[model samples]
Target: MVKMGTFFGMSLGAFVFWQSMDKVHVWIALHQDEKKEREEREMEVRRVREELMQQAQQRDSVA
Candidate 1:
């Protein structure tokens, strides 16, 4: 009877651990995707600013 109880307890603990680990994995994936998107947006902003500055410089030189 004690052995049966021990087996049940161990099985429950294993299931709980597996579920928590799955949640952690999902969270990490979401954070990584967000970081990638943020970096892309920042790069785009910098490119646009550089282009605008170049245009302004060209106009000044022409005038």
Candidate 2:
């Protein structure tokens, strides 16, 4: 009877631990995705700014 009780307790603890870990993993993945998206947006903005500057220089040269 004591062995059975011990087994039950251990199983319950393991289950709870696994559930919490799963939630943490999901949260970390979501944060990483957001970070990647932000980086991509910043890169695009930089590219656009460079292109605009080049166009302005071309116009100035023509005048």
Candidate 1 pairs with clashing backbones: none
TM-score of every prediction relative to native: 0.94, 0.85
lDDT of 1 at 40: 100
Model 2 poorest 10 in a row by lDDT:
4-13
Instruction: Assess each prediction's global lDDT (C-alpha) against the native.
Output: 1.00, 1.00
lDDT of 1 at 6: 100
Scanning candidate 1 in windows of ten residues, the lowest lDDT window is 4-13
> How many residue pairs clash (N, CA or C atoms closer than 3 angstroms) in each of the candidate models, in the order given?
0, 0
* Candidate 1 RMSD to the real structure: 0.7
**Pairs clashing in candidate 2?**
none
Q: Point out where model 2 deviates above 4 Å.
A: none
